[model samples]
Structures are given as C-alpha cells and as structure tokens.
Target: MVHLPNTPTREREIKLSFLSIMDIWSWICELPNLDDWSESPVFELVSSGQADQDGSTQSVHLRADRTSGSESEAAVIFTVCLQGFPPLNAEKPLWVSEKCHVSRENPFLPLIVQLVQEIIALSPNAPNSTCPRAQLQKLKPEPIAWVMDSHSLESFSTFFNLVFILRLFWLCACDAPNEAGSLYFQSLLPSALEIVSSSPLPVLRTFLVTVGIDTELCFMRTLGYVVAKLCIFRELGVGLQVLVPPPCRSPGFSYSTEAHGVWALKGYASMMTMMKVASSDGLKPQIPRLDAKESVLKYALAHQQLEALVQLEYSVAFNDGFIQVLARIDNIRLHVAKLGFKNQNDEAEYGEEKHFPSRVRIWVGPEVGATYVGGLSLSRSTGNAEKEVEIQKIVKGHFQNLKLSKGKAVARTSTKTKMKNWRMDQEAEGNGAIFDAVLYDNATGQEVATGRPYGETSDDPIHGLRRRYVGANRPFTKTGSVVLAGDEYGEEVGWKLSKEMEGSVLKWRIGGEFWVSYWPNQAKTSFFETRYVEWCDEVDLPLIPGKMIV
Candidate 1:
C-alpha cells in the first residue's frame, strides 16, 4: 500500500481556492476599476502536480467532499488545456493546439475571452466595465463544459476562421454607411461596388485588415481548409461547400460569434443551418423507407449509427448565373449486397448480395424547383469478383510459403467446403465502383426540375464530392449532400432563375428528397429509400453587400 500526503483540510481548501483572491471575472480585466477594458483576454493556469506512489491518479478539481483527504495531488489537466496542443494528423479535427501558436497567445484565446465576456454580460447583474472591484462582484462567471469533436487543430482554426467570416457578413450589412470602419474597408475593396469573393481565406484577410484582427492568427486559423485549384469552382456559383459544425456539437450546444468590437458579428454563425423540420421523424428515423421497385436501401440515418465516419459541409452562394451549392458528404459508404442467411438460428442475419445501385442521383436547391445536380451509373456487381480476389490472396500466400509449383491455381470452394458464414463487402475498399457521374435526367422517372439532364460531364458539371478515406481508396458514390441542378448559370452552379423572380428577395427554404433507388443486380430484392431533409433555410443565407440577400 502507498502512503499518501496527509494535508490538513483548511490548507487543501485554501489551495483549491487560491485564485479566489480574485474571482474569475476580476481576473479577466485589470481590476475593472481603471477605465481600461484593455488586456481583457487573460486566463489563469492552475496545476496540482502531486500524485500517489502506485501511479494511480485522481483529479484535484474534484469537489472537496469527494477527495480522499489523505492525499494531496495536483492534476495538470487544466494546465494542459491552456498550454498543450492536440496530437498531429489526428483522425478527428482538432480545434486548437499549442502546437500552432504565435508569440505567447493561442489564437483561440481571444475568441474565448470575447465569448465569456458576452456570457457574463447576460447575467442579471452584468459587470460594469468602468466600475471598481466592489461593483464587479456582480459579474458571475458561468461554468462551461467543453465537448470537442476530436483533438484536431483544424477544429480550432475553423472556429476562429468562421467567426471572422460571419463578422464580415455583419459588416456587409453595416458597410452601407460604415462610418467607423469605412477607411479600412475602402482599402480592401477599392470600389464599394467591386465584389470580393466570400471564400474563407480571402474573407479572413479582409477581416484581419478591416477589423484589425491579428494577421498571423488568421491564416494560422484556416489550416488551409480550402485546397487550391478548387477555388475557381468556388467562384463559379459553386460555393462548392457546406458546413455542419465539427463533432460533439450535439443538441443544446450553440456556436455563435460574440459581438465585442467593430469587426464582431451580431451572433451570426459562418455556418447557417436549417430550422426544425415539420416532418415527424426529423433526425430520428422510424424505419428505412423502402421503395419496392428499388429494393431495400437501409440508410445509416443517424451519426451514432453511421457504418463509417464522415465529415460534411454544405455551401450555397448567389452569383449572376443562379444558385451554386454543393453539400460535401465526405467518407461516403453504402451497402449494396450482403451474404444471405438461409436459416434464422444463426447469431447474425445476412441479406442477399446487394450491388451498387443501377443509378444514383442527387438533388439540392429550393423546395419547388429542386436542381438535379447529377447522376452516377455503376458497373454491375453480379460476378465472382470478391471470391476471385480472396482466392488470389489465398493462392499467393499458400504458394509463397510452400515454395510449391509455379503452375498452381486456387480453385473456387464447392458448396459443402465453403465456409457457411463467409461474407465480404460487395464493393471495393473505399468506394467499390467508379463510373463517370453524368448530368442526366433519365436516371429518375419523376419530372426533374432542371429541364432535361444535358447528357454527360461535357454537357454539364458533375457537382458531386469524391469521398475517399485513408485506406478506402475506391471511389464509392453515395447521396448525402446537396447537388444543385440548373440550366443557364446565373448566381448558382448550373440553374438560372425564372423570368419573374429576377432582383427579388429569395426565400431560401430547401427540401431535399434523396431517392436512393436500386434495381436487382444479383440480389432478388428490389427497393429504394426516399429521405426528405429540410436541407437548409432562408435564415442560412447571409446579407452580403453585392451578393444576393438571404
């Protein structure tokens, strides 16, 4: 048994509340008595390095009653949060890591400080910036529990970059007569009439200069989210982007930019989301809606139930042509076939072989005239390809180890010799199949809104995201994003506006009905799934200066 420190109760309490000399609120500002609100972003780092001999550890932040009272140990977790950076090449997006910082300040610290100030101001007795310490006592700091997506530094950069962009939109509304920021704004946009691209990097530079945001931190915040070469697609009404906040942003959590200074936005998110859908099963699915002719398409409807991890961001922007929008569904995966179970007594039930759908189509845009962005036709998966691959692997390994005849070939296993439970994913690793996703209307029987599909890629654009994970290199096409369809390009990707709706306030309520229909390949069952998502709302569109209004 290990002997622990026998620290006195009073001594432990005193140390726990060391920062109590001044409450958290008082610590943030310079005593709050001076007329200065300068140096507002300050944080206290507390650590209790003491630990037990067995090496087992307990947190020091635990409540006084919960402690053993026999041992006095400090847990440096809080210190790590302040100073440490997350791991490199983290599978999940990391928000901020000390790994990437400039000078002494973490780029995220300022945003956190401003947000905390915003929250503090919401209390019944808000802190008076010019008031003395006695009056500052009214400001109570609310406890915040952080739920991060992953330990990815990208998350942090995205957060800061997003706030900077939303603030730009807020500036867009105010720029009409931006008296306070006009001098700086004019320098970036030579003529108020000259439109600036809404890309994150460009907007960040704009925010840094016009709003006096830190220069180094802005680029550092992007982590180069937008890859080069795709920037042109972004301009051609292809905002070619969509964003759902990173992981752990579950219900009850809200991400809003704090309105602190001239550059600050009034609680606008760079990511605008669809309001609550009137549908009965909004995100909660009852059962997969199977269209009999297309076979059973059991979609992994919830993130908790996803077969593979995926990150998605949807973006829509107005241009002179039409509305260009794309919802990037990364890590796309789907089940086309499964090994069938003949008897019910087995541990798990498998279905018959499912191949890639005959045709996969994507629709995204307003409810009435939804744009059919594109369609994909996959090669039939009815052959013995999977068995052939396995046989080749087994034969190669067997021959290599035995140093046997070079003429040896592995034969297909007969019915009795075959493993009863043998099963393999019908498609290849990443995306089992690859074919040109063309722009066509024949893929669906219903009356598609975007005129007729203009044949193939040469005719129109294939506005689909090619999803591939580290090991899953195959290009599998799944419909989980917004694919807008249009004829004459106006402000968006491929669609043109009606003659009546020009120069009008567009109500941007999007209802995307993703119909994944599959005819039989080898599997006899035929079914499809139609999922209606209120993909976006008018509230999602921003009020840009020259760009179309929300």
Candidate 2:
C-alpha cells in the first residue's frame, strides 16, 4: 500500500460514487421507452380541495405515470397544513404535508419496494426486535429520471462537472481498479453516446473534458471501447466527425496528445469489423470517406515523427484499425522500412548492405561424439539482395576405423565431414569473416560485449553460444562446462553452461573436459565428433562469453 503525498482519503469514495452513478445511468438507459419517458413527464401535481372546515388546510394529489399505460397511474394524496389562509401561495407555500397515502393499484409504486425487500431479506432475525424506520429512510431513488429530463445546458454542465470531479478523484486514487472503471464506462456507453450526440459543441467539449479526453489522466481503454462501439453504429461518420472534428470544419480543434490519435485508429478498426459483419449478414455498410491528410493512421505513419518507429509498427500491426489496411497492402514490411524503421528483422531484409564476416570459429562440446570435426562459418551476397544473413550451426558425428577382436589388424583411417550449414542460402555466398571477438565482461556483468562478431545486430549472445557449442539438437546436462569459438587468432571466447537448479529435474549429467570436432564437406564419413580433452576449471582468457558461469 504505497500512498502518494497528494492522494486524499476521499478518492475511493468518489470512485465508488462514479461507478454507482454510471451503473444507475446504464439501468435507466436500458429501460424500455426511455425517450418516451423523458418526453412524457413522469409526474404531475393536482390540487384536490381544502382540508379543514375553516379552509386553513388543503389536499394535494401527485400522480406518477407507469410504463404499463397512460390510463393506469399511481396517485399519492397528501394533506397540507397551511398557515391561516384560504387561498395560500401555492408556488412558494409555507405548508407542510401532515399525512400521505399512496394508492395500492399504482404500478409505479414499487420502485423502492424491491430495494426495501432486499434490505429486509439481508437483515438478521432477532426475537421481538423492531426494525428502525430511520435506517430505512437512508435509501432513496436515484435521480436518473431527473437527469434524463434535463433539457437545460446549465443542468447538463453541472452534472458533467460532478462526473468529472469523481473521475479525477478515481484517476488519482492508487487502489482504484482501472478495469472496473472501464466496465462502468462500457455499460453507460449508450447513454453517453446519446448525450454526446444531442449536446451542442460547447457542451460536448465540456463533457469531453469531464471524461478526461484532453487530460493527462485520460483513460484510453474506456475511451477506445466507447468510440469503438459508436463506430459500429449507423451514425459512424457523424460520431467520428463529432469526436474528431476536422480542422477545416473547426479551426480550433486540437487534441492534447496522440492518445486520441491511437483511439481514432481503434475506431477505424472497429468500423472495418462492423463493415465485415454487415457484409456477412447481407447488409450494406455505409462507409465514410475520411480525408487522408487528417486521418490518424496516416498522420501517425507519415508525419507524426514518433520517437520509436517500432512502436508505431506494433500499434498498426496489433491495432484493429489497421488490420484491413495491412491485409490490403502487398508489402507492409517494405512500407514500414521506407518509414525509417530499422530495428526489426523484416526491415533488415531490405537493408542496402550485405557484407558479413567470413572467417568464423566453431565450438562444440563432448556430446558431439568422438568421430568427426566441424566448425561454424559466415557467408554474404556480393551485390544488392533482399535476404538477411543467417547464424547458427548443428553437427552430428559418425565413427570409423574399427579393429576386430579376433584378428590382429591395423587401425583404419578416421574421417569426418560437415553435416549441415545453418545458413544455406545464396545471399551470404560472398561473406568474409570479420576478426571480432565475442567477450563477456564479468567486471561490468555485460553478457555480450561490443567486440563480439555481429554484436551490434545480435541482442542475445548466450543463445548464439548455445547453438554453436551445444550441437543445436543436444539436450543440456546438469553439469557445467565452457565451450569456445574463435577467429583465426585462437583468441577464443567461452560460454559457461549450467542447468537451472530450481524446479529442474536433472535426468543426465556429463563430467570431464572435451572438445567439439568436425570435418567439413567430406564423403563416406561422419561430419562431427566430440573428442576427450584435458579438464580445466577455467580458461586463462581475459574475457568470458556468457553472463552466467557454470
């Protein structure tokens, strides 16, 4: 429970209130004939007659309309005690209701009845105990009906302000569940859309601010979900126009950040989904024609100047908005490459340079067997090519030169040949090995140092070492060992291999020192073999190759 200095205790209270309010709004929105209820007036006041003989008291009747029908109405009769006047000031009367009774046949009478029943059901049974009426008075009907009937901008503005404050409080609260807030927003989406569509631009702007659209604390998931749902509706074009008003239509239109831009892209994605759904259902979808220059996706890719091109690429790749667009584009990788993306492997295929190191050192462990010798190599294309260079090698060895036990025969010649080239392509044909050493610095604890071959492009040097020495297909044993691979200088780099102890079952263990041997391009012989070598605890080298030691 880390608490910030600025966070107040009322934050949780405000968040719960917002969720309750939204839930209430959702229930009201889902009610049948809401538009009719909003227009038809739920309550009507009628005066019956004078209450007393002196006409000092009066009787007032209040009728509430139910959804059942206009003819069936609930009526509440109240006897008002007026102060010494026959004809009292009805509008601003100082009269108090003395007695009240509601009609039993009223269908609208049980709005609070269900809630009261629920409370009573939850209460514990006590012997001859009277339930307090004051406790029950705390429960009241939510003012959703009032909000729906509010036509004045001022009322809406005040309501928006309250919601805004509640949302702000929730945003600053550390314990608030973001998903809960998102769910509430999703539930109230229909009502929110209705409000946004009906409100004027100024009012809409205020409402947007209340929802944290232009604020630093904007809720992206909720906003995206609402906009996505709206995009699926028939008023797709109009909804987008309202949310993202074009600069030409309104010169003052602006967004605080690219958050809205990302959401707009999501909306576009949802629109595509809607179109697909419509097409599948044998219905025509009214697709809106958006200006390319004003488009969020186009702006993000073309001129947004994002700090990380990979981020934009990922957003487009994963975002629903760009799915159809990506499918339509023949060469999305090339398109992204032209947008100055260089970190991804797909972009590397389109790079100008094909120069790779030629002289390579191969390392192998005792698991490679005792019959063959092999090493790793590098190759590159001479001219412009579209293929990226390859790295990794695996070798299996075969044994030869056997002597019979019965006869005294001379030992036969042993030979080995290269089994597989990890990189078997024409692009790396002209590859020349660069004299770079792969060193692991124990002092700084760096896994792969800058001096390693292809260090700039390779992020995981330990993986490379594993592939080179452990014979790609071999399973790792529990014991630890060092395998070295080097250039022509014999200044080999070593990787320490060890099994993870926690939750690991050690099925096999290999002991003693050994070396990996291989014969390249040989006929009628094995390509790889693991031969016995003198065991040493550590190599007398200045730098290691891997971060972990066995």
Candidate 3:
C-alpha cells in the first residue's frame, strides 16, 4: 500500500515547490488587475496519494470552488499527477514526471505570459518598450535559479478556454489604434506570423474557423481591420493563411451545418470587407482558391440555407470576378436551376420554369417617345449557348425598326396607344414580382436607379434594391431614375428622376410620368410610388418617328 503525506506536510511541500519557480510566480503577481479576475476564486492546491509502493508518488490537484453558483459549475480547475520524484543528483533537482489536466474554463496564465514574452523577445529594443524581460528583471532575487520550464480533459475544455483568451487578446491588440494600446501587438506581430505559419495551436485554429462567422459584426469588423492592417504592412499575403490556417484550409475542414450557415453570412461579410480594402489599396484581393474542393455554394446548398445563398449573390454583385468563380462549380448550375427565386422573406417561389422571372430586367425607353420600346432579360442560365442564341433573337426583334442617332436608339415599343392624362392609384397594388429592374442609357450602357418593389409597410428601398439585385457589382451613380409600370390607362408606368442634393440628399421629381407618380419615402430609402393624382388636362404624347419600329 502507498503512504500519503499528511495535509500540513503536503501543503508545505507544494508551497516549497511552487515558490521555487520565482520567475513564474513573479510574472503571475505582476499581471494587470482586471475587475472580473480580481473577483475570481483563487486556486486551492490539494495533494492526493497515488497507487504506488513509494510514498514519494504523490499528485497535486488545483481547484476553485464556485461562489454560490449553479451546481453544474466545475469545481476543479487543474491537476498535476506526479509520476515520480527526480533523482537527488538529477541536474534539475525538482524535476518530476507528471501529467496535467486543466479545466476548460481555466485560463492558462503561464501560456499567456509565454506568448507575451515571446513577442517582447522578438523586439527587445523597441522604443518605450515595457518588455516582459525588463519587468521580470526588476523582481526580487531568489536563492533558486529560476528557469522557464516547458510543460488537458475537463482539462481539454479548460485549455480551449485559455487558448480563446489568448487569441482574443491578440486580435484585440492588433485592432487597437493607439500606439500604447498596440505596444504588445506591434511586438507580437512578427512572432504571430511565424506561429500562425508554423504549428498553430489546434484549439486556437478551431476557435477561429468555428467562430469566424460569428453573428457579432463587431468581432468580424475588428478581425477584418486587423487583417487589412497586416496586409497593408506586407506581413500577410492574399492567401489569408493566418485567418485560415493550413489544417482548416482544406475543403473538408471540420465544420457543423450550423457553422456553415454562420460562415455563409459572417464569412462573406468579412471577405467583402477584406476585398473592398484590398481593392481600394490596389492590393490583389486574395480570393480563396477552392477550385479543388466543393465551393461555398455547395456548402450552402447542402445545408439548405437559401438565405446564405442569397448573401453569396450579394457578395458576387460587388466583385465581378466572383461570378466567374461561381460559374466554374458544376453543382452551381444544377442547384440554382433546381432552386427557384427567393422572395424578400427568403421563401422559394416555384412556378412554370419559363415564367420564373429573371433576377434583372433591362427596360429601354426613348427620350422622345411615350411608351417603352422593349425590354431585355438577363439571368444565370443552365445552358450558355441556348441563352446566347435567345438573347440575340430578342435584341434583333426589338431593334428592327430603330434608327441610330449619336449612337442612341430612337424607337418606341408600339404606336397603337395614344398618350393621355393619367392619375396614380391611391391604394398600393402588388407588382406580382419583386421589381429587380434597371434602366440603362442605351448609348453608354450606364445603369440608372435599380428598381425595388415595395409593399405598403416596406421601408428602406435601397436595402430592398440590394436584396432584389444581389449581383449588382457596381455602385449607384449620383443621379438616377426609378420607372414604374401599371396595367391600366391613366394609371400606368413612368419614371421618377432624382438629383443628388447637398449632403447627399436625393431630390426626386415626377419626370413626365405616363401613369406612374412620385412614390413617397415611407422609410429612409426610395419606394415604388404607385399612387397617381386626379387626371389633369391632356398632354400630347411624343409621336414615334415614321421610320421607328412599332
């Protein structure tokens, strides 16, 4: 049977062993006092007897009791199971073989200190540096020569928590703008690059991948800012290997279905910010190369996350090249064809495939004519050759009778309907489809205002427009027009032109509405104003030129 040390004897021995590591103790004591940390329960060291013939085989367990908290709370924080005592003549007199188990919630103070020390070591001579070495050197001398010694379960969880804290601090420091606030960050970056490039802690890597798509916009914003700064400083390349380490870089990176959904939203947001910054700075946007594996589109579809797919569409709008990337995925065409248009509420709209309206509609109206001549439809097609042929036929049919003057088509859709005084309908009516229409200058192909169908309770037309036109890669010009079409005479469709005012205000007017009237701004953005006024005196509509097509 193994003998165990008495409580007082074990306590004395543990104290002696802990006190011998003067530098580590000093570092712990010097940690800045955080409010929550100060209030946390201190660790209580306990000694237990192991199943060994020698009484020397003892283990040390570190625990912290919950402060009147839930019973589910963890009581033990850490454990050090000593295998055996070192030989008396061993170079390291106190060295012992041991196994450590740390609580998932316990913060590994030693590892954190080591990371800070590594950073300080990298930049020992930085101006006004409060390096860890300098701080430790000022500590009181002890008899024992202190050496930094290198060393999970309930322990794995504790280690994960500790790693999380380390990553959070590092990320936060990198984001801090003030020099003093970023002192540690500035010192740590070089080493951070190496750590990330080399063997990053698995727990830390997992944390980043899993939470990379967190709902907290601030976290992503901050992470993106830091990433941009790193890129600007030439510390990181377009690969973004730091945020996505090699292990998690694989297409089959371990992520739950929920994680994929979160990534579909937050990951896209982060990537957009990164791409925008890179574009503005003239740096090559490092779009991740997922050619060998299933693309994000596949992940989104597998999870049945249509909203995520819609978000992807919005991302592609700002970056034209993304469309090409999307096109290369074989599954994309099949999936998109199978999945019809999603409405504002993300509900799928399924009907006759031919009647599945295009995501974008191009309307052409002559400056001199009362009626629109013809419209063009553009959408992702499963068959490119078939789509091209169909497009050519439609263009030929529409432009058959148009005469070009200064590269502009002077044409009308039809001459049968005569222009007349019309009033807007007071009650809002459904357009039957989301208005994802765009007006373009036929001569220059420059886009006008993108149309968004609005309901009576709808607000923020700009946002609505974004949702409708998910792949609009261009910014809205300063001045644009929104055209509305109605089914009835004197209650028809027309354009409302807007001019940019001082402080970015948009001044809108009913620029010769055939049947459409000015929509009121119910929310912050423009909405379709279907309501018309009482019919006024008749005005002569512009007649189609004799040579112009019907």
Candidate 4:
C-alpha cells in the first residue's frame, strides 16, 4: 500500500441505491465533489420486502470508502468473509457459517489481490506512481504490453468489473462440479453472454485481451470442465458455448503486424481432462477428442490451400471473435527434430481421435532446425442460448403463424439423401504468397516450387473454407411462406379451437422429430443424432400484447 487518504473530510449522499453498481458509478462521476478523494459517498439501500409492522421501512445505508486508509483493512475483511485468502490479520473476529467450511486456502486469492493492487495503482484516481519495466514485461504477451507504458485507470475499471465475472466463472465449476446451474454460474452466464453478443466485435478484440492473461488462462482451463457440466442444463434448454477458430500453426511467431489476420497456436492441458482420465493404475489418458488442428490442416492441404510440405499443427486459442484470414499459405519451412519424440520420428497416431502430438520448429523457412513457424490465433466466438418455458412458446417466433381460428405452423428439417450437388466445383488458392512481403530482391535467394495453376473463380477450397454445412442443407419446403433447401421442408398444421374457449385459456402440444448426421469427410468420427423436440403453448382467445402468434 503506497498511500491512503486521510480521515473522511467530505461526505456525498446518494439518494437511491440497493446495489445499482453501474448506476452508482454514474452517480459518483456526477458528484460535485468527485475529485476530492476525501468525499465518501453514502447510499440508501431499501429491502425488497414491505415495511415493518411498525409501518417503518426496512433499509440500510452503504458508504463507499474508496482510497481510504481503511483499504487494506477492508480488503482483509472481505477476503476473510469470502473465505478467500486467510489474511495475516486473523485476530479479527468472524461470523463463520455453520453450513459452510473454509476448509483450505483459496489459490485464487493471491492472484486476485495482486491484480486489484495493480488496478488500484493504475486507476485514474490514484496519485502518481511509477510502473517499472520488469512489471510491464510480467504483465504481457504483446502489442498491449507496449501500450500499457502509459496508464489509463478508466479502462482499468472495466477490467475490475470483469474480476467477479471471472470469479463466478471458476467458482461455479467448484461449487457444482456436475451442474452449470450453480447459484453463481447460472445467474452470471446469461449476463456474460448478452455482453459478448451485443458488444461490437472491434471492442471485444481491443479490450478483452487487455483484461490480462490470468483471465484467459483461468477460463481456458475451466472451459472443458464447464462444458462437461452444461449437459446438465439441457432439459432447461440453456447452454454456454465457445467456438475457438480452428487454427494451424506455421511453426514460429508471426513476422509482422500485417499478418495480424494470421494465427499461431499452442496446445494446453486441461486439469479437468487430466483428472477425468486419471485411473488407479496411474496417469493414463483414455479420452476421446476431435483434433480440430489435424482436421483443418488435412482439409487445407488436401485442397491445396497450403503447400503439401510446409508443416502445420493444431492449436487451441485464447483470444477475440471471428477472424478473417488470408486463405492461402504459399511460403514456409520445417526443421525436423532430432532428440524429441518427433526427433525420434515417432509418426504413430494414438488416442481415439488418432492424432499425433504437436511439435514446434527445429529448422524453419530460413533454414532453421526442425520446426513449424506461424502466427497466433486470438479469435473466440462465444454465445449463450436460453429458452424460457413460455405460456405460448410454440406460437412465439419471428415466423409464427398461429392465429384466430385457423392457423398454420411451419417446421423446417433436412434429410441425408445425398442430393446431387448441382453447384460449380470449389477452386483452390491462386499461385501467390499470402502476404505482400518481399522475401528476396533478385529472386535468386528465394526457393521456388511448382503448384497447380491459379484459379479465377473462387476462394472456395481455401479462402472461404471447405463449405461443409451447405452441402447438408436439404429437403426444400413445398407450401411454407419461407424458402428452404431441397432436403429441408416445413410442415404447417392448420389449428382450430372451440369458440367458447377463446376468452379463457387454450393449450396445445405439438411433437416433431429431427435428425442430425455428420459424415467423416474431414472429421475423424461421424454419427447420427436423432433428436425429438416438442413445442407446447397456451394462449387466450384474444391475443395478448407481445403474445400475438402471427
């Protein structure tokens, strides 16, 4: 603690409260005495229930004491209350819960405290402080590291908000190892998804990485674990999904920022995956997985998007959203290993997915030793899907048609009949380098290789990717208002109700069957999943506002 403001010299009273966090900030910013750290704001928080029997309202007053001498004291108090870090000030009294036990020290405490202290020092309100070079290096992985040479406390506050979001992320898995609906998890996930979905992609790309690698590392490990637990919520139709762009590593770091669109990847071990596969015999990884890296590389090379000889490996990423990459890889190199497992030329494929372990470069493009060189991936697509059991969910949608007496419902589906693909064949990449970089001046220093003639039509095989799902869209609709693929169709059922039941409540249940199939085109495994979905709804004769099924 470098410094703390003296005793409260001024007090600001907030007229409204009850934990309106964002609103409270607005109130604080608008305060006439805002610049004076000496001013402690008092907020009035009312109870959710009615007034007491005496006709007096039940309420509490919360005082925000920022930058006070009590900061360290408060930090310790909160840490103990949350049963977080067992502070050195253990002499302080606590009202421990009988049902809960602080059995062990929380490993998360040290990091969070460090982050908070760093955030406090960098915050816009703090007095001048020096950020040493060593600390800056420790804080980063890249372009952001250099940017932080100057401080911006305003943005630091955004990260501070994400602090609890990250906390709930890890704690939910801890509290309910088997369910995504734990108190902390279920409540926070929707809000998280909303923010991710609504925010502009540029904003997410710029700041999310700034939140620190701690968040990425923490959540990355929690990913498989959390996803494993999400099937528990399937019955409620609530799901959390994160789609990391399948990446292929070039063998080394990206050379220049122009290749910002390029991606390099590193493999990580998940604690959940490790524990799930652990057995009494010892540490044996008897798990099944889909190697997105191998699949992507194979797809790219098979279609001639990348040279057949340049090495590539699959990498799991921790970064921003959907990325637009240069569809071709024309230049590259590999340094075969001599001492490692790969150096021993262990080309055997193991595990259920039959994937070879990943390796880095030994000799790269410029005649380095055995290795693979490439850019890093930072794109992550995350969204949350929640279905609330509505009184009229069946007839509630943008395409709803159920109405007055005679109504129609459209259901679209597909079939794996392998309909003939009448479309033109997708062409591969042109005879060109992915970047505008001039590798050589006289062209004598450059190593050249023969490739298929460049195409004039499309980036299909490489630029836009394999176009897997489009081939699967089928069963064209016959009589629905909307269009559907030849293999997909919509069944509209004309519904009628008794006139007397109009003013009252009317309920109906419709059942439907659908099939989802995956072929082993580039996938390591394929299977058919038959899902039977039911649509149920209840409606009053006179439609309600926001409830009209049309």
lDDT on C-alpha atoms for all candidate structures: 0.24, 0.24, 0.23, 0.24
Write down the TM-score for model 4.
0.28
Compared with the true structure, the alpha-carbon lDDT of candidate 1 equals 0.24
Flag the better candidate by TM-score, 1 or 4. Answer: 4
Model 3: residues with Cα > 4 Å off, grouped in runs: 1-183, 193-218, 232-550
Per-residue lDDT tens digits for candidate 2, residues 1-550, read 1122222112111112323333332332233442344432211111223334655332221222233323323232222122222344242222122111233332222332232223233332111223332233333323322332433534443344333323322222223233222222322333343333333334333333332321201222222222333333313232223222221111111121122111111100111111111111121146734434223221121210000000011011112221110101001000001112123232233222111111112111213231211222332233242444444444444345545323333434444432222121211111112222223322233322112222222222222323321444321111111211111122221122231222221111111211221111111111111111111111111112222122
lDDT of 4 by residue, 14-102 (tens): 12222342242233334333246465555332121333344543222224333323322221112111211123311222211111111
lDDT score, candidate 1, position 267: 11
RMSD from true fold, candidate 1: 24.4
Poorly placed runs, candidate 2 (over 4 Å):
1-220, 223-550
Candidate 3 lDDT score at position 30? 36
List TM-scores for all candidates, in order: 0.22, 0.17, 0.24, 0.28
True-vs-predicted CA distance for residue 43, candidate 2, Å: 7.9
Model 4 ranges off by over 4 Å: 1-160, 171-183, 200-204, 207-327, 330-550
Q: Which residue runs does candidate 1 get wrong by more than 4 Å?
A: 1-485, 488-527, 539-550
Q: Name the best candidate (by lDDT).
A: 4
lDDT of 1 by residue, 66-160 (tens): 11122232111111111111222111211221221112233225434343233222211101112121222332212111212222333334333
